[model samples]
Target chain A: MVEKTPILDTLTYVFLVLGILIVGFPIIYALIAASLPIEDVSKVPMPLIPGDYLLANFTTAWTKGNLGTQLINSFIMASGITIGKISVSLIGAFSIVYFDYRLRKIAFISVFCTLMLPVEVRILPTYEMAANLLGPIQSLVNVMHLNWLIDWFANYDIDISLNLSLLDTYPGLILPLVASATCTFLFRQFFLTIPEELCEAAKMDGASAMTFFRKILLPLSKTNIAALVVIEFVYGWNQYLWPLLITTNPKMMTAVIGLQNIIPQADDLPFWNVAMAGSLIVMLPPVLVVLLMQRWFVKGLVDPEK
Target chain B: MIKRSIFSNPYLPYLLILPQILVTLTFFYWPAFDGLINSMLVSDPFGNYSRFVWFKNFIALFTDFLYLKSIGITLMFSLATAITSMSLGLLIATLANRALKGKAIIRTMLIWPYAVAPAISGILWLFLLHPSYGVVALAIKKFLGVDWNPVLHGGDAMVMVIMASAWKEISYNFVFFIAGMQAIPKSLIEAAAMDGASPFRRFWNITLPLLSPTLFFLMVMNIIYSFFETFGVIHTMTQGGPGGSTNILVYKVYQDGFIGLNLGSSSAQSVVLMSIIIVVTILQFKYVEKKVQYTG
Candidate 1:
């Protein structure tokens, strides 16, 4: 066994310290800036000491920036999206992994192809289609389609219109993103890792496919499900462009949009304290989710190795 | 084995894939297909496309100097960032791979910033490097004493963008590299050491060559990720600004499609971008893949 050199050990510490500082600086700086009083903020070479205005700053950001409503908007939008995406991905993944059909290869390839295509390119056409096709149908059915039989099953029908003014609306934000490629991919990969013997044994016991998946695979994939939850939550929280496109009303905006709005238009602007406060608020959920699921993230990363 | 009932099974594999199938058709493939169609026609007042104009947008794209320059700039940015990030990642991974104390703590801290979204990372750097009142700005002014502004300066902006992006990216790539390196059997390295090889010599001869397969995979993925996935940073930091010096093709696609209200042109640009990536990917698989051995 070879012992480490003193020089190497010192170098490692130095490298680690420097790397940690560089990485942690933003959040650290944000915390300090957000906690500082307005008077202290004016000091040149801004004071490094923690100030006592944290509550005041939080109150200001909440009311002045309307972050309360923004938080609600973001939660509703993200939750709707999460539910829709999970549902679609579960169904899609099950089909891709379990079903034996012709065009399965094409389905897989098309999904892979979607992974490479930037969402920006399709924004325009999607907007037009959502407005014309989905909007109209939804509205048309909402009135006449909501009937006595409908009272038994589900709540509403699709809206029918060519209008796209529903940008900030929940349906507007949620409808276009009902499916996710990454989730599907993850599910497929996880499903493939499960031995077929369990499925065969279940089949021999007279279990249906749906029953097998629900009772067997679902329970076995607790880790994957946890990983997917954290991943989906983080993604939904940090999403920027699509939400920005679909939502124009300030009341319906997310924390991300709130962060953007808080940025000042002038030089020597953005009022670092306020911006930092807002950024911290917006970043809190994702960071917390990651921290809680830190083990899951590590496992997710390593599982690919196996 | 061909069960006749399987063909008419109500819930077919294709049906399982139907939601995503519809999503892809309506969103990705259909729009791309529509773009190809629209490229041939002019947009009318009623939103109706006119008669065909074959190869017009593609030809126009070639003639446009700015578009061509953007394509070139994107390639440069992707290449520079990928190489810089991968090299830094390898170095960090190698360092982390040593029998070092607090390595787990170091790994956690090193990867913390990667949890920060790309948009936030750009903003953090922008604030830190702001010409006035920024921590780094004041230090540079007091020490170097030259007017150091990242905004209005092209070279500085590019360097800042690259540094910010590369710093963020290295952590991600390093995670993969570290994992890859850890997977390598320690006995191989010890066996090489028994042959009178110095640590440095062993690293060069044994460690690096063995890590090449993972490195190659990283190289391909990192390059592609940089090419398409860097729009968030560009959009937030420079918005391809300081006289369009930082506008990569993907950023240009965002600008053209959303900002400029020119869907046809944006689609044309995306098609070109797709072609470049596809070709590069194919070349990597066809040529470079044969040279490496993935033990896993």
Candidate 2:
């Protein structure tokens, strides 16, 4: 931009146009394909132009793919993750930034440590734990030879065994995924920028920590909360491996995974049109969020301090 | 950094952090610890017999040709995906940064791909490249006279997954690259331009060096992206098929543990992956710390 020579200016536009073409080609093709008739979709060289079957393909996809349930599941999961992660992270960040506590350093380190252990790295164990939330405790009791203690208590008509499973449930889908430190770190970084005088003023007013957080800090965090919501919502909606691992029930499957179900079976004709429509449906929500909240999304993604 | 004026409530602080700590411990530490323990314990496929054999599973993993092959494949895939995506991202970002018109519209158009899930992106590419009726596949066969079936060809499958992964990641790298480009002081560029340096020379001499930190950060992020995040892409695309061509480490762990029921090997693989992530994360943090010092 300092000295944009005419030739260089033309070259820039040329490359950008080419880049956009290549980048946009797949989605454009999918749109065109999705609009085509079922038979046209399977043509050796599928029709390039849009057709009249857009609604028909979408209808078939929605009905056959069980997309209604899947979309609802995805919405719940994405919203749950955004809300749960933000609230937990907000409080955790508040504790770290605004309070002096004995275990603060340990808590910070533990949360930071989770950054390295993404769900993929601990998939099997996480699945097993989700299958039985109390498995670790049960194992510990067995390891500690506390069966006799339980038996003794049982003899006195007391039972101490505990069992819970999170699989195929919304909490299961949301909670494990929420146990990351990105949002906490982001909030902590943002909190560090706030003036110390605000806390002093709140303290002078004899406001409780909770009240200050509610009345002052929460109001200040609106932009940050919105940014993180955009990022986390997209993240939650796009999750595939975790949901695929835990949600065995069709009714519980998220839209991204459920898109697979809409694909015609191996024996059936490959109705690429219907599948393309389903792909569009599954992609719409997160795409819309990103487009609508472009500023916050970019800030959440690129802000180094976060 | 603690605030100068702060709240001092021991119980409330603990209560505030308790949810985060509890969720982390149960979901992260518990599973990670279980993975470490399970890595040492060999169990039959049916889970009827089990015994702790310290480091045996890891030793077997290193010795096994298939596992070693998988490691090689994963490294290759990660590098290919990262480099392809980063280069394409840089190209677009550089162009977009220079263009004098419609900057916002161009950015909006290009960045929507970032929102497309890897699996959905894979499906989109699949429709384009599917063997029987895929438009591009047919064109390649017709014009190039080359069979383009990912289903049957290992090389083709690898290319397919890489294309899909790179396509999805370009928007992320593009966003970062644009930010990096904008952060480079315009005065520096203008001074270079005034000094009779060619556009290419100025960019190569100044812009590239200044952009190295962002480049390095994006490199690590992209490698991590291809390693773990592309599970959906590989799963939906080829399922690591055509004779185990695309079986990246993450997908292999899923396959071995859930499908093959090799708990010991799977757990060992998970430990290896965790260690890989930790090392990469440490490397990133170290570089980031150095960058902070340099900038400060």
Top DockQ model: 2
CAPRI category for model 2: high
Candidate 1 wrongly placed segments (more than 4 Å):
A38-44, A79-83, A134-166, A267-270, B1-15, B44-51, B141-146, B280-291, B294-296
Cα error, candidate 2, residue B230 (Å): 0.5
**What are the per-residue Cα lDDT tens digits for candidate 2 across A48-147?**
8799999999999999899999999999999999999999999999999998888999999999888755799999999989999999888887788687
**Residues B150-176, candidate 2, lDDT per residue (tens digit)?**
988998999899999999999999999
Clashing pairs in 2: none
How close is chain B to the truth by TM-score, in each candidate?
0.87, 0.96
- The weakest ten consecutive residues by lDDT in model 2 chain A span A153-162
Please, what are the lDDT tens digits per residue for candidate 1 over residues B194-235? 787777888788778877777877788777767766666776
